[model samples]
Target: MSTYTPGESFAHRLDPRSKLAVQAGFAVAALAHTTVPGLAVLTGVCAAILLAARTHPARALADLRLLLPFLVLLPVVEGATLGPPWFSVADARAPALASYRTLLVVLVSVAYVRTTPVRESRAAVQRLVPGKPGRVLGTGVALVFRNLAVFRGDLRRAREASAARLGDERPLVDRMRLVATAGLARALGRTETLSLAMRARCLSWNPTLPPLALARVDVPVLALACTLFTWGLL
Candidate 1:
């Protein structure tokens, strides 16, 4: 499960709804400020949040690795589009800001995911969103968190099994295709099992989720969210 680490930090104690509000606030706030200094503030706040939650910095950077190549490519492509000397700060600024904004968003999201369990996340969505849309979205989020670890394990096993069979001699594209196919098949099988289990349990439209309630600790988090919105307005 995507779960909370054992901790007593303020962020760890804040209500999931409050954290969700702050996360949404951060995303909206990020859009308002694209300048380097503005982005620095946003990035700093995200980092601080992660730190407050006692998450390791290395883990935070590791979470960012998947997007690093794209982040690097975007600015280069934008700058190169300007011809000759092939480096226009003016042309590159937008792409750079966009990439950094994405990084900030991911960092904050990682902090949230690490500190909240899949169960709390599902409950947060259901309570905050309401009705059919809430149920659909909550289920989707829950499934993603629940299955991500399983998919990762499947991927690792596929790589090991491929290596055992001298699959390294195959072209990169072929190797990737094989692994992808294996992973998808496993995922489908897992899904079928889960569906059957749910059906056996009388799959209801309303699956019971644990209660998420606001507490005294949420006051500060809500305040921070309000501050973020105000800053975004400015």
Candidate 2:
């Protein structure tokens, strides 16, 4: 289990793997339908998932903030690849659809992670990968979740160390290069150690054993969610 205790609300009661299936359905539906209205509906569904999970509003907002950088970038690509006016019905549609798709996937993932144990999520994700991808991602989940605070502190210390060494005389570009190199080296070292430690601790992903079972009753609920998303996509 990760130090990050996922909220145990109504939504958390569902099987972790089931929620992931629903996310796959939503993602498929989002890709199938590209209109603004369709995307809005999908975004609303994502918001509803968040609400149902009963996650903290502040945390949800923070997650939204994570999407900000992408929000700024999505429009430029939409305009260049899709068309002219940034705000037009035709031009904005691609970006709007993209924004909503990104939001939907992110929110679903957040809700799932916030509900399931980090290890359980890792195990579920393993089902998707063929050979090495599963193990690699599972390793990330274990190390990243278990030592999240430490990793964050490492990043902060690295940045501060860079800042302290940076003088007014140094060019901004040079400072950035130095900071990037320092941060990358430190991050790589930490990850390598963590990976080795994880292996020593005997971590492996066997997806057959879920922390919670998908109850017989839960199947219809997932089926309903899938049906709704599928119908709307059409």
Candidate 3:
């Protein structure tokens, strides 16, 4: 998802720090739950977040479509693996539990990723690093995340271009050569241009923070996030 400025909502207005805590706390709660009650509580938490946030549930859920397959398969595969052996196929239960645990973790991460802007998320990380090193690292993270869509688009275009040449039926090596070369060359040229632009702007070094002032909005935003995180523990 593009990390544009989110719609103005209570969630969007939160300080980067509170938002970060909420995201982290949500993840911890996701991993801590396995029973029906645990899953219900976690699901309720996500539902409430979806309701209160600036994010459109449809779009955020669409971003999560990537997880659909695993959610479907985990229970099925696990049950299958454990069902045999004359009424007790004990083998599959472990994998099932493991898969479910992983799925919960992934779902929680998707929520965080969809809600938080890449720039804001990275800036929240800056407190630990400080100075030029922190800024550069943060900006680099933002830049990489910003490019995900462009690179994915380029991959699709490359495949389409090869298919146009009837190259899809070609030998695996030949087809891969076309796709990889096309995609990598595009990424390389873009990186070169980006490097030159950064040098021209003297952004070769770390970026400086803008002079904007933090507003009163940040206070309660942080307060509630801390409260919610503590609530999750209880």
Candidate 4:
């Protein structure tokens, strides 16, 4: 849900590739270091990344609210047992750490998403990867970034419309069905519209994109990424 906003923050000025590298490195590190001490260090790193992006931790967590339930559920499901004890704390610890690691990775990613523009992200992807496959992946990334907010809005509207019709009074399953069906229909309609718009604009794989250049400032950022990657490997 965190979209790019025009800003002069450190993260905004850094090349998208650097940001992407940090995200990748952080994910690797988080996965490699799932211990309490490791997570504590990563949490501090995550906070620093958020600060660099000029994003608040609360806002980042709020944006990721949709995923929180599943994160919370994972440990619970893992801990639950069919025996008399019903639950095992030892069994839950590993999954709980894993879930926390996942959260840290996602929070780091939120910084990238918030600071990097969709086009820059696409360009970075295409640059990192070459040729037709890269173009296709870049196109997919651009479309997803651009359309996600619109799709979220469509779903919100659908839900509000359903509520206006007293749909909330219906059974939970019925309400879910109505909202889901409406959202799906709207998504299909939007997909068709997007296709037509692309055709009208003559969407091409070789379209001009904003140039990406790493500045002197990016050196430290890249170094940080490398450090994280090396730490993960160690």
Clashing pairs in 1: none
Comparing 2 and 4 on TM-score, the stronger one: 4
C-alpha lDDT values of all predictions: 0.84, 0.68, 0.66, 0.93
Candidate 2 lDDT tens digits, 1-234: 113355657677777677877777877777776676777777777777778787654686575674667875786566554434434556656685677577667777777667777767676666666578887887577657767667656766766876686543578887667767777787789879977986897865543445556787568659956875776467
Ranking by TM-score: 4, 1, 2, 3
Give the per-residue lDDT digits (tens) of candidate 1, residues 1-234. Answer: 234566687777878999988988898899998888889888788878988788776787786776779998999888885457768888888998899898888788878888887888888888878999998998899888888878878988998899899998999999999999998898899989999998898866688787777999899889989989888888
User: lDDT of model 3 at residue 172?
Assistant: 96
Flag the better candidate by TM-score, 1 or 4: 4
For candidate 4, the 10 contiguous residues with the lowest summed lDDT are 1-10
TM-score of 3: 0.71
User: What TM-score does structure 1 among the candidates reach?
Assistant: 0.90
Total clashing pairs for each candidate:
0, 0, 0, 0
How much is the lDDT of residue 227 in candidate 1? 89
Please provide TM-scores, in order, for all candidate models, with all chains considered together: 0.90, 0.73, 0.71, 0.97
lDDT of 3 at 118: 74
Listing every candidate in turn, what is its Cα RMSD in Å to the true structure after a full C-alpha superposition?
2.1, 4.5, 4.2, 1.1
- lDDT top scorer: 4
Tell me the lDDT of model 2 at 161: 79
Candidate 3, superposed: residue stretches over 4 Å from native: 66-119, 167-181, 204-206, 211-224, 231-234
Q: RMSD in Å for candidate 1, one decimal?
A: 2.1
